[model samples]
Target: MMLLIKNAEVYAPEYVGRKDVLVCGEKIECIADEIDRLPVACHILNGKGLKLVPGLIDQHVHVTGGGGEGGFHTRTPELQLSELISSGITTVVGLLGTDGTTRSVENLYAKTAALNEEGVTAYMLTGAYGYPSPTITGAADKDVIFIESVLGMKLAISDHRSPHVTIEELIQIASKIRVAGMLSRKPGILVLHMGDARSGLTPVIEAIERSSVPIRTFRPTHVNRNADLLEAGYEFVGKGGYIDFTCGMEGQPSPGECIVEARRRGLAKELMTVSSDGHGSWSNYAQDGTLLEIGVSKVDSMLQELQKMVKELSVPLEEALLYFTSNVAEAMDIGNRKGHIREGADADMILLDADLNLDTVIAKGQVMMEDKRIKKFGTYEHSK
Candidate 1:
């Protein structure tokens, strides 16, 4: 149904003043100081004191369940649609991590489809945690170029659990993703999982030095796992590469602190993004590399971090929202369509109360949540 929202203090992720927004079908029709009566049936919402901002885009998630690190019994459960919508995430990028053996890229693909059908935009990477990673079409490049939902390849580097593949192997995969992205007009990013090894980002530097693949082709995650790595991430961004900081980290500075430090260091915030690693397993390891504790991640961490940036660190809401919205959308090659609030953009927005809590979530013109309740759920979330 078309929607007409009146008196919203809009933040297109850039502060557009209080105005009326008209939605036609699944896209935003127009935004103006005043929108006259529509010619068709429409759902009207009064937004007199609400903040209407573009719905969040969470770049990293383990939608099909990401953990098996401690054994089969320790693997996490599949993500529920309510978890995402209630937490204000309107889009997600799902991928497998260490347990790619039992969990295939096929599982990630199926879960992506399920989330899209449940009223959110979902996409996924096609590989995970190993050299010669698994792909839907038997090759990362083929899957990226041929499959609609497959965006790029994922692999674990600089981690003990990783395959420890040679630099040559890394080059081969990166080359395929770069070429496939060029052919398909997609971002074809190489989403590297950063582990807590002492080498930090040396592997990424070696890969860039050994070959000519553009630095933008690489998207390293978990860059804030440690102070040294976070500093390396700043350097990476300075060199024109993109990196993502994981939220919900334990015993470390909050994502707000990291962003503040980045600003103080004069790092390019435009190339940085934040991800929740929702539904993945986060392990607490002893120096001997023994797992001391295992816990699951939550999607709410992403939203909480955004609020902290604005409320605690005094970051402007527009700049704070960009890291989670436009920055991520641009990295996926879908920036114009997914992240901002503009004419012809997807009508994915959230309504926030005066205190900045989520009051409503609308994805592609459909209400997924309102008044702090889940209005939609995944296929199984509502059923047995």
Candidate 2:
């Protein structure tokens, strides 16, 4: 598979000037100012007026279904590949959320495999919201080491859905995940789901205070759910931890506010990331625990936030993109292959128009989307 992309205003997430990229098979073979000649079989893309960048990677996505909270009718449908391709996402991390009983780790793993086999790169965490979280091999630690795609585990902290773990339990679980990561030579960090509670980060703080585990082991997501949670979450980020914000919700802080606030506080830019939480259920409840409303998150929201950060917020292109591409790839410990555009890196890229709309998407040297038309879909995709 030889592909030649010509006259691309390239930003390998760092503003590399106009260059031509050559993709050989699944890897980038060469990148230069000009490629005078290529084999007749090579596919060429005229990238004039288009900026080519590393493909966007969504770190938190529910590829399989995620809800069951309200009852049997509320379980979300599995994510579709059309949603990802049109949004410029070539790599995604899938996880199980809320319904560990009805939805098993097997289903999540199967979906992950299906997505990867279809087109994009898909990875997943092992456990879910409960204590002694569900695992394929019956042990979370062993699953992380033996499973090729199981990189870490996810747990809900300070949420009504969580197991309400003690400090000791937190320490034990974190320790196990960290050890599994070490054994597997992968990033075994815990992905924490934060809720709308008064004790925002109390459990995380207590765990850090009581144990010697590295602070980076915890990744508290949905920090931007509320102003108070963002405020408290920033403290953890200050101390060498990471936080993820969910995008596309109304009544929450805009992209400008969050990025500007992070700059003002001088937080670690690399530790910050944003996710769509796509295909998961977003619920609103009354004080009495009755479900009032339910809405599903969209994958397009991640692309929307990326556009907002660059165009509306006046953030530098490179700086604004780190939260979606390279920064996220590094956090997941797959930076070597997934993130940047380099000689030996994976051939996953996206071309954008002046307005930042996705013009084309290529994953693993295969063209999946072009000119706003989707060219690829999963195995069981419906034509209608």
What tens digits encode model 2's per-residue C-alpha lDDT throughout 78-114? 9998889988999999999998888999999999999
**lDDT minimum window of 10 residues, candidate 1:** 375-384
Each model's lDDT comes to 0.89, 0.89
State, as a TM-score between 0 and 1, how close model 1 is to the true structure.
0.98
Q: What clash pairs does model 1 have?
A: none
Q: Please give the distance, in angstroms, between residue 211's alpha carbon in candidate 1 and its true position after superposition.
A: 1.4
Q: TM-score, each model? A: 0.98, 0.98
For all candidates, what are the clash counts?
A: 0, 0
lDDT of 1 by residue, 1-384 (tens): 888988999998999899999988789999999998678878888889999998999988999898888989989999999999989999999999888889988888988998988889999999889877888788889999998988899989889988887888888888999999889988998999999888888888898999998889888999999888888988998999998999988877777788888899898888889999999999988989888989899999988998888888999998998898988888898988998999999999999887779998999999888778888887776575
Candidate 2 lDDT (Cα, 0 to 1) = 0.89
